[model samples]
Target: MLPPGKIPPEKLREIVFNRLGAPGERVIIKSDLGVDATAIDFGSSVLVASTDPITGTEERIGFYAVHINANDVATFGAKPKWFLVSILLPENADEALLAKIMDELHESAKKLGVAIVGGHTEVTPGLHRPIVVGTMLGEVSEEKLVTSNGAKPGDAIILTKWAGLEGTSIIANEREEELVKVFGREFVERAKSFISMISVVEDALTANEAGVDAMHDPTEGGITNGLHEMADSAKLGLKVYAEKIPIREETLKICEFYGLNPLALISSGALIIAAPKENADDIISALEGKGINASVIGEFLEDKDSKVIVENGRERPLERPESDELWKIV
Candidate 1:
């Protein structure tokens, strides 16, 4: 049986990616391991589309569904303009539950200036909880289109925000009573507010404007998995400093309580950017100017098999996490 999180990359290549029937001629980007969104050639502009489902937490599922998919499109240097959702409820769900979800979806979409174009909603059988699947669409000019495969060997890798951001919020919300008993209501509430930082649309756009060869939002499997995906997609090796990667205090305490590796948790608010060494400083500066914390945590290397992380002056091979640390707790 497969793990509870995303399918392993090897299995994905064997069972899923290799099984896609006929390839579309207009598809500029096809299904791949690291690439989250697909681009279709449409004359002067390319249409970028991405889909993601929220099943980790019941709280703010609608908000998560919208921003998570939107983040994928924005990582390709596109502005998400239209959204579609499929809401599946459990058999015993009530109208109040659906109403709350719809309200969240509407507020989130409006905040992002995206239109809810169309979708389907139904009560699914045998489901224990509600699941919201969202698809986001955006357009970008051919010249401005950026893909995850564009990172070069010498480019500097930049990381925005802190690691394990989404997982921290999910844990705080899902385990509120337990956490509050140990850490008090103030700390738990602060951790829960991490949900507000779940979107990386601004981070991607600012970095793209400052000049980035590649950009990716760290979703499931946190920043470590995200860095691995970036290197794999670019066909390059990377050396990142463990000390340079930021982790908030709330996340640290919460992870310690659960014996989880923050770097291996789900991270949505953070972004991974690869840019030429010469432009890295400017990119960081632009992101910081917009009040988004960013740092050059590493650099891609010419050796494709040299992925490593430097900590305390020692180098260790960076292992790809089998599953997100969030699953162990929530």
Candidate 2:
């Protein structure tokens, strides 16, 4: 059986990355494990594109499809402009369901000022639920483009929002009955509302404005894994302070109830921004000015092979996250 969540990077390198046809000269950022989007050089500007499939969430799948894919491009300091989506419905799908998805897509695209240029829809032979895969394209001035590989040693590692934001919302919405019994209806409802926080476009844009060396959104494997990806791309080591990482009360209760590691859960809303030590505070202030909470969690190291997570007075090596903690309960 295929593994749940993301395919391991090692396997992806051996089977996918290593086999890709040589890229053209216009290709600025090619396929890489940590790099979020591909960049193509276009004279005065660079076109960035990112694609992701929304199969993990049942509620608001279309909305998630647009925002999630657009987020990748925004992390590169690009303003999303166009979207292409492939909506695949199960054999049992109906007209009403299709309309619902389309409405969501339209609403989300409008909110983000993105145009839905083209897409394909089909009722496939799949025996289960619906899926939406979206491709987001955006442009950025050549001088303003940023990549995950730009993180430098001694740069402060900044993180925005709390851990498990998307996962918490998904669990609350999809598994309301189980959660309500333990956390009560009010708390569960509050957690479910976190779905609206799943987009990191604002955080990314603000960090870009404030000047950042690198930016990465924590998604599948949450912040810890996101940090590892940043290090891998930058060819540097990292030391993350566990205590500095924020976790909401609702996330704590839910993760504890499900026996999941909050840090290892899917966290779409959170962004990991690497900036010079002097600029880190300004970046944090800029994000908070826009109503986003952020903090400096750690700094990059000169040793490219080392990665550590420190808590209290003890420190330990940071292991690569294998799977998202959300899969356990979902």
Candidate 3:
């Protein structure tokens, strides 16, 4: 069943069309709507817009809110330029909490040289908790516009960073009290630090610089889902090596405890880019130079049928993710 506050990505998309009429002239949706960001054609520059709202884990909400939208724009091969935020707080919300969130947003934006041009805030009964919605604007040259659909046959699949980083971080933060009581404080503390691993600005830029054809950030649906979308959008097939994907010691420990697959969990800070086989080495090295984890997990095949090769040598067809159990565990 769908959660009370959450909507399926498709249903949410239908609502968008229902309001805006047919997306034409003004909109150029290269990939499926509701995936990361939307790329709008603007002649010389492609305008990419992404709006993400922060909910659930409220402690580091502001920090994640900015990066989440920024990452979406980055995946489109754009430099995040502007932000428009919408902040809603409960009437009884503490002033200190609001101040802290604003401060965090400002600092993060400044680091990327992004300006918060305008936004609105309100304290009302309609909101029981704090919610921050960040809408980002970025520009990508038409020549360099990256799409999830840009994957090509024989392109090497490169995944950077540890798996399940975002999911593990959310779980630890949202359930810190219980986690500490059950999983030990050290583990919880380590997991919370995953917050710093939440930037895609470098990952996408470096991959594009290395002449990558496609870029996708694993979010909401995890790496497995991310790979499927990339292949599906490109009308291509992918071969994945389960053993080659990176999984952090902490992320794996928590996944094993919860009986979850790390690769299928949401990982925002990490990005998957399909680079020409010749550029794979330079791409990985560039990302690593910035102290980021990067790896070649597999490659695209001319065969339209996609499959993931397990560590045991078994093969399984890639499936469109029906649901993300990420929220359940975290």
Q: Which of the numbered candidates is closest to the native, going by highest TM-score?
A: 1
lDDT of each: 0.94, 0.92, 0.82
* Better candidate number, 2 or 3, judged by lDDT: 2
Model 3 misplacement above 4 A: 1-23, 26-34, 124-126, 181-183, 303-305
Best-to-worst order by TM-score is: 1, 2, 3
Please tell me which predicted candidate would have the highest lDDT against the true structure: 1
In order of appearance, the predictions have TM-scores of: 0.99, 0.98, 0.89
Considering summed lDDT, which 10 consecutive residues are worst modelled in model 3?
1-10
Q: Candidate 2, TM-score vs. the true structure?
A: 0.98
Q: Which pairs of residues clash in candidate 3, taking residues 3 or more apart in a chain or in different chains? A: none
* Preferred candidate (lDDT higher): 1 or 3: 1
TM-score computed on alpha carbons, candidate 3: 0.89
Which has the higher TM-score value, candidate number 2 or candidate number 3? 2
Judging by TM-score, tell me the better candidate of 1 and 3.
1
User: For model 2, where is the 10-residue window of minimal lDDT?
Assistant: 1-10
Which 10 residues in a row give candidate 1 its minimum summed lDDT?
142-151
